[model samples]
Target: MSAEKIDLLNFLQAHPPFDQLPQQALEQAASNMDVAYYKAGSQIVELGQLLDTWHVIRSGSVEVYRRSGELYNRLSEGGYFGEVSLLQNRPSRFPVIALEDCLIYLLPKAVFSELFDSYEYFSDVVEVEDRSRLRHSVSQREDANQLMTASVKVLLTPNVLSITETATAHQAAIKMSENGISCLLITDLQSQICGIVTNTDLRDRLLTPGLALDTPVNQIMSPRVFSVEHNQQVFEAMLLMLRHNVHHLPVLKQGSAIGIITLPDIIRYETQNSLFVVSSIFKAQTLDELVSLKADVRACFVRMVREDANSRMIGGAMAVIGRSFKQRLLELGEAQLGPAPVEYCFVAMGSMAREEQLIVTDQDNAFIFDDNYQPSLHGEYFAQLGKFVCDGLAACGYSYCTGEIMASNPKWRQPLKVWQQYFSQWIDQPTPEFLLNAAIFFDLQPVYGKSGLVKQLNQLIRYKAKANSRFLACMARNAILRTPPLGFFREFVMEKDGKQSNSINIKRRGTAPLVDMIRVHALAIGSKAHNSFERLDDIIESKLLPNGRAEDLRDALELISIVRIKYQAQDLELENEPDNNIEPEALSAFERKNLKDAFQIVSDAQKFLRFKYQPGRAS
Candidate 1:
């Protein structure tokens, strides 16, 4: 071969199919690829060619178009066209024309077949594209289906197109004219979505009696509503909707409308198989099994990040997993240790305890044993049980309680009297260590045993916190110390040295501080929500944060959580390391800015809390 041929072969051989193929086979295949160049506006993959050439863009832009009346958008470099030929065994879905002077590497269909006979990787490449297209088609079908489902979360699915029941007859007519929806569901305060108001409703109710377009929907809305449960399959739901001659079917779960899923979300999640893993975890049997399910969960984390799973679903799924771990661990512990003689409760003290932990963080647990009787031999049996169960948990990859906060630690595994005494002392007089301890303990979720103990403990904590707001304010000030690891202008605050050098401490500085702040607020208000997001919502609802600023705070914190999960996923790929510190530089400008806003919210909330109950002011 000529030197130019040699250089071109070297490049092609290093790229994809060649990289995977046998060296000699790759060299042989490289000889057949035509080095073609075209000027701007030249047709590359003509509309209905015999599909002879499969081209990968080497330089410049390629515009793939269907006969949509005019030129479509141009695709940039690295965007390959002609996958339809390889995957679908058909001609190009659209014509591809160059938008700029372009260089292309053409792999002829004949050469692909010839190369395929010798190259397994070449086939693998083709398979990935085919599967991806199928996946996309599947996703679109899912999206359209989910759009008809109902939800209190979002009145409609992620698709912006939706119609409301209360929407006027005239408005429905206008909406149908513009967007082509036959109907829309009317949602109530309970968010129970039902009753489709179609274009027919407009004609029968408004146009018939010379009625006004502004007529209330309740007058003419179809009371005989056809509906499907949110959990039902999209095809099943579609069939129900179609069978009833209803274009809109309100979706329900436990009588609360979560969202109006048309035919979309179901199809999307099903095709993706990323979120599919999350639903599977609901059926997990044991802690070891839950631990085994980690790979799937981490896969979900990666998929969600890549697929851009909505913040709510992503955060909600994480909280579900964290709770699942706690619940399973508690069940296992209960089975192994047997029921305590005293009324006792297992508490999740840190992230797992907070119900806001992102992905796979280490577990933090402790016990509150009832001490109604001064059981003479209580100490030995309970301590031994704590050790046995906690050790069993460690064997399942929870890691030992890093802070020894588990029931295995005598101090943490305290009697109810001792816990109450400790709480009284800490809240009455907050110290740095005490504040830290309170931050953890206060966020506890009673996973097993007597939740009443945890409840009573919270009741006492909240009452005392309100009575002595000064102590709570000091706790808030301490909570602010961790601040969101953001610098002067919204840059990530990085570690100066050590293994996590140049990384953001997501647990401590990023998420945990917000966790602490929310715990304090919840305690102050005596809110029943043990989770961070829920507590934030409670605070917002109670007007605790001054005109829904808590919403902003919650959003900011959620962004931290998303980043934490993403970081965890990255670390998992890098030797399955537990992800904690996130590299701030890895974040986008929008995310970095959001992190800064989140930290500022924490700082501001802490300051306001302090101002409300600072030592001098409190007295």
Candidate 2:
């Protein structure tokens, strides 16, 4: 190979679009390319310049800016520069200028067309972009910090080793020896967090003091818990343990104890290079690499389920990793087109924004920029970021919301004042459409940029809703629409649909009803735990649900969660579909019975909510 061809070939083997090309084809691509170098601040493509070549940065970065002097995006090494011009076959809308001394591989339009025609995968990047309409508004992010988990089946331990909070000190010790662990968590009768006893506590407190074996476990169990949510990285778990000077921590969902995490468990989960990509995602230089790391994310979830990881732990970890990816994507976007004169915070609205994502989820996002942004200065920057994030997420395996709730919608990306106006209008005149499905907005959490903005807005929402009886009633009435699945005879009801269409609809009938009910309760109480589980806990404390009812609802929610998890695991195993649906026929009689009772409990709560909110008649 010629010297130029050899250098270009090596470069192609490393970058995407060409990285997917086979060796011989890549060589042909390299041989067909011409190389060019640019000095800092040099213009590679001027505005009104006719379409020419597709330029790839082999080294250094280029800033794509409008001739009107507005900065567009920063494309660095291994990034393509003139795609816009090459794509439309017209004058460049954005001029490409070298931000630093740069090495660029210039592929003429003819050669690129030939390559695209030959290689099928080469067309995906464009196809993915062209078809991805909701993609142009949100900036993508990547940050890799790992807590260990399995990428394959992990060894699960059994023998039902656990201790009751009422168990005596002697029983705790005996159980520890029997199970061979230094630490044991005290589970309450309700299966919530109670306390923990380490082997050190066992030896130091019991043996040292010669305490009676019959003393309650709670008496000696050190209650200083440094816990993490489930599915949180083992690294985060380790850090929490280290910071709290605790050896064990309990993981909770909706304020109920779910599992335990320890330093040793951390070490075991991330065994065999699990931490490598977990750490590398943040260091990725290009968007392509971020897309690649997401594959590992799917692998982690698959592995977590295979290990029989509880839903709380699995969801917690996935939330963290998903946040990391988006955070990184945002960082890259901001670095490329941010620090603008105006303040803009990217809001992840649905699963992502709320730090709750299922294995197969849809994107929900919106932008809240400072109202003072001068159109001439910040519009393009925010626009580009919105586009990048929405698009990048789709590439990372989150299907675009069919409902078009993404930040890419110009209607959603607006100034904070505008957002307030939007919410105020939506709240004041809560229509059936808003009530039926708009709770996704209620679960809003700031995932990136200016969390204070989200905080301020949340405060306003509480202030507005607390006194707006009509609005509250509307929300509550809507919340009760999905009444618990109690039958006329109060029997456990399953889906009427058989094999093919049958599904218990855990998310819809079970979790969402309770979740929405809790949201209304939270609005009344102004609770900060927007999540259904956490919000329910707050409701329990607020005395909204009668003590007995609260207890029942908690158990119902837990059962729903546990049921969802088992189904999810089975789905992964079959490599069938991964969804929230549960077939009624698949359930054991006990499960079906329990699910029905759970459904009834939620339905009762729904009735209470509807009565409280009186649909048409009011006091």
Candidate 3:
């Protein structure tokens, strides 16, 4: 082969759909390839122009435009065009323009057709009319389980049971026992599902605490009952149950609570699942038993990956497991150390709090004591409680936070007033170092104890953060510091100084920046949602992003998160420690393309952030 043909073959082998072609066919096409060059701003293919060959970008960039003259897609090196026109044997519908001086490879229609017909992988990527490349990425997974496809309404029973919000705990228990129900949905005067009281909640909140039987069930019920729409799939219902570890999910139809679904219903529908581990975790009676469940946790994580659970589903499940561990440990701590001298809330911050935790995370938590807390008198008890729970968590595989952000840290163990002040200082007089500590704090959730205290903190943050423009600017600036892993050439920029040099930390480079920038938008919109995905929903609804950017961010987050999740699952399968650092070389051609697209989205979002909040530059 000539040197030019050899170079063309090498470039084609590096790109997708082409990379999947057989070597012999690839070389054949490369040898017959025609080269074309276009100057910046020049039209490579105008609307309705006859295009008989497929164009692959070899260098520089190109912009594909719709007939309406709207920017459709911007493609860099290794990107492809002319496939739609070539496949259909029609004139160009979407015109193509050179965004910069460009070198391109054109393969004749016959050769493209031969490869497209012969190669299954080639057909998968090239057939964009049926399914998008992004959807193709996820659809490649096996989704055969009946539960995955069936609607939650299929399992719905008309035997709905609920109690008034004003009902007593004893009356609720009686109602549950008389009805042979394990849970009763608590409704208000408007007959709306306000909370849920379960057997476990009664055991933990009423029986264990020796609360008065006449006390209102609302005092013991979980106010944040995660319900599902009647039309959602069974898999979604199961995911919600696993995500929040809730046994009962009230099913709603047109905004009215109509029925409920349980874990057993799902288990009967699909037995080979990980949610059983959560039920077992609450059943553990000792620290050793809880710690031993770590293996089960790993198994569940692996099963989710093999079952083709998406990043959001897997992350939510793992986070719920993590929270269960914390909750069970707190129960044990109270059992061993006795009840607390004062009511306090044990808050899980960071990823666990955000509902985006993975199997490889460390503990990031804090304690919010009651405002009436007396340091000299009750300090020792709370201190010991923190140590007990934090130590137990480390035993169960959630290693201590290296930065000492755990509840055991004295710096984070403070009264409600102090926590409020902490937020005020962090926001009102934001500094680089303070912002680092404050990142996790902003995504806080109360896992145990007086949950009301955490609500107060969240309310404080929402009110304070939205009103403070300077603070938001500082946060936006801090968020922009963590750039995505894309280089000027659209290649992944890897770590320069580390043992894993030349590799990218998917968490820092991909997910972190995405989360941070989203947080700024969430703060700007005064959104109460904490999870990155939910925050994106709010940001989109608030109309805070340019057209298509919110969905771009969502897709980018899912792709990066799924990649991170799959790699971690791979580490578990290999019995090695799971981590976030991933070498680009290890990725498949398809994954590399998708990941690059995700990273580019992150980079675009960062640019938007800089432009949106240009603090110093903004007049």
Per-residue lDDT of model 1, residues 1-619, tens digit only: 7996787667766665455566677666667778789998788877666577778666677666665523333455444567566646776667888767888888777777677666555665565444433433334232222323322233245332344656666676776678656666666655555566766777777788898878776667787876665445455665675687665556654465444554444444343343455445445566556567666666555555554444445555555555555556555555666765667777776666554555565667887887762447577667776776576556545678677777788888787888999999888878777876787777666767788888888888778877776787777677667766657865566888888898878777867777777777787788877767788878887787777578767766776777777767677667677667777678764456556766777667667766655634423
Deviating ranges (above 4 Å) for candidate 3: 1-272, 617-619
- RMSD to truth, every model: 21.9, 30.1, 18.6
Residue 551's lDDT within candidate 1 is 76
* Residue 266 lDDT in candidate 1: 42
By TM-score, who's the top model here? 3
Tens digit of per-residue lDDT, candidate 2, span 1-619? 5786777777788877787677877877777778889998898898888866888888887777766764555566677866656767778877888877898888889888777778766765554333222121221212222233221113222222467888899888888888777778777898755678889887788878998878888888887656654334455566777777776666653364555556676555553222444566678888898888765776577665554444555556666666666777888887888565677777776555444456767787787887786657677777788788889888877678888887778777788887788778767778876654457787778878788888878888888877788888888777776765566987545567756354567787787777677778888888887656677778888997666676677667767876887787678768777788877778865576667767878888877777777755422
**Number of clashes in every candidate structure?**
32, 29, 0
* Local accuracy by lDDT, each model: 0.65, 0.70, 0.84
Candidates 2 and 3, the one with greater TM-score: 3
TM-score to true structure, per model: 0.53, 0.55, 0.61
TM-score, structure 2 vs. true: 0.55
